[model samples]
Target: MASSSSSSSLKFTVRRCQPQLVPPAIPTPREVKPLSDIDDQEALRTHLPVIQIYRKQASMAEKDPVQVIRQALSQTLVFYYPFAGRLREGPHRKLMVDCTGEGVMFIEADADVTLDQFGDSLQPPFPCFHELLYDVPGTQEITNAPLLLVQVTRLKCGGFILAIRLNHTMCDGPGFKQFMSAWAEMARGATKPSIAPVWRRELLMARDPPRITCNHREFEQVQDTLPSSDQNLVQRSFFFGPLDIAALRRLIPQHLQHCTTFDLITACLWRCRTKALQIEADEDVRMMCIVNGRGRFNPPLPVGYYGNAFAYPAAVTTAGKLCRNPFGYAVELINKVKGEMTEEYLQSVADLMVMKGRCLFTTARSYMVSHLARLNLKEVDFGWGDAVYGGGAKAGAGRFLGVSYFCSAKNGKGEEGIIFPICLPAEAMERFAQEFNLMLGNKSQPQTSSATFIMSTL
Candidate 1:
């Protein structure tokens, strides 16, 4: 009897190897199928072009800057030869172009910079993803599709700012980081990379050619219909010390019955965002959390899967109810949404991609802006030292603001907080900051009620 009991207990423990969580089933408009007659080989032959321009150091003059840049572009193309074959798809398998072809000009400004100055510096950011590709005359149709743009600005103080505008389709934060590392290696003149680029498509390929699964149909949404203007948006950086984050983590298990640190933090932000916006309970408020699908799949993603390896898993709550709920309750909602991030769900999405074929482009255009926030930026460091400050998605883009938090390695600050670029109405921005500070225990003293909120500049 004792031996039997022990055997039963061991089996039970093995079954719980990371609780089985699956995404909630959402209904899809229709079932789509891949084109039977299309040539798959021809489809995969395209490349994601890259453009870059380097500013020569002062005291060094080039008679023909354009000629010099042309040469540099040719050399960079050779350096990118290995990666040329990888970026052939639209977004996930999509290519990335180096967009520094036009000579990058330098601007001298005061030590103190304003938001407008920064914005001005990145004028006419890459219009589309294809534009980042090489400037081929007839291939202009393909190369001019500018999805990502990068600007490496040399400051008068001897520092450089590498600003990149990435199309959401290419890759999420992690994918971008991988590409950057590769680019850096090329820039440093390394014959071979410390980290070899992985481009094994078969490993990422779906089980069989027509692997049609019902789950794939539900998550498909058109991306282009997303709102384009977020002019009223505002961005602010917040710091949560190690002790504070640890305290929150400890309190989480007690408050939210079942959840992780990521869920709790997201819930806290979602609640605060709705409260500050004065959104009503009946209206749906969503928090889109990005899930990295690299190692999550069953067979696992290839090392060189450079395309978009991130998916948006969303949780929604009404404004009134969210504000009234405890932080833990919100955390549970996040957990529920995260639970759905399974290998089946990711493969379902891939299967959908294969089926939709041409229609996929139209679908991507419609559902782009659904109030999503990504949390993995904290892990992005170019080795120039962990990013002291990092953020993207310029203000005035969407109703749902995206905030990315980075982990601070310096000073052992365990998972340092995020730098949020919020797109809220002007009036709501002030209140959002107040609630944000309150979460961090930085509220004003009882003696000064007026001091509870302080407005921040863009």
Candidate 2:
């Protein structure tokens, strides 16, 4: 069982696990190559930094807290060796810790508000951890340790929120979650963690190198330089109640002739988005769905194989054709793409990594982003509660936007269904909402779409 503290200034409980005996070292040989040797230009871009924020009441933890956190961070770094790697092409990663030198002013009644309230109050042009870094033009060119920003706030009610930003390259969501759990365990004075960290690379190797069957080049996007335009990218959140999801589930069977929830909802959104954006008939539009690869591989992977364990199954259709058909047609497209999501495909993907002589995996930036999002991101939790909102680290990037949807089993209404963070043209977002609401027979509240709502709560 875990021990919990209910301080007026802090509302989180710590789970304590028994320590494990030190086991004899198991030496597993693996080969690791430098990023330059990988022949992947885009791959290098995927290693950008991540920003993290931590909030807490001024007096709740310790006096001179920056030193305390720095001390803890020093110990935490030992367990995360991936961060220790040197940047072969650029400067080393930088890890910075700063205090909320100045206190924040909140409306008096705001103290009782939940996480959702704080999220809603953020203005449209608000600064997420990423935006703060983006404002600095030359920051992206550097490759160092993840930029960790810790903000300690003193809430009127005494409790606080700890926000953490991590670079996607350091670890995927599951990898980061495990790291946090380990950190929390260490903070609570646990001598050992229930699950020891493993960094074996052989387990992730493909049986054959260059297992190519299909040409993946079609999915690649070439860029001479990063886009300078910052216009039209906006972030917005949408709430889908249980009834709304149930209606979608029912409609799938009636229309697409399928019984699954994901297929049905995805189809409907695709239709609405195409209609709203008023995309040209001949334009190529795709909806990329993430497929978890943990249990799908042959001789199933261990429960602890925590690196990237996902694949993208994308469905592409002309904007005009998609809008002209019934929602069921879109559902079939989803099913077809999903059918290709198998261990063979993943192995073949790995084979391509071997065949390309490790260069494709390193130089392919678009491939890295497209594939990294397929990993399981919904499992992160930090003791304040199971994550009601979890998503990719950064947002607003390419032609194929990424969206992830998950239901809250820990801190949301039982009647709540699924909430998705999506990215589409501004106009398309509105159409998606309108058509989605029509499918649910709820026409009262008009939908507003802008940028991808990276964080979501049901």
Residue-pair clashes per candidate: 44, 24
What TM-scores do the predictions have? 0.58, 0.65
Instruction: Supply the global lDDT for candidate 2.
Output: 0.42
| Cα error, candidate 1, residue 33 (Å) | 20
Q: What is the per-residue lDDT of model 1 for residues 1-458, given as tens digits with 9 covering 90 to 100?
A: 00110111111000101111111122212211111111121222222222222233443342233222223323333322322211223343333333223221111111122222232122111221121122223322323333333333333333334444443443445555565555455444444445555534344344566465534222445233334334554343333445545555664556454465566556656776677767555655666555677778767776655555544555655666777865666778777776666766655555655556522222211112222224333233332332333444232221223444332222222344332334455566578778866765663211111111122332
Residue 395 CA error for candidate 1 (Å)? Answer: 5.7
* Model 2 lDDT at residue 320: 72
Cα deviation of 125, candidate 2, in Å:
8.8
Runs of candidate 1 exceeding 4 Å displacement: 1-143, 146-148, 200-231, 255-260, 353-387, 390-417, 443-458
lDDT of each: 0.40, 0.42
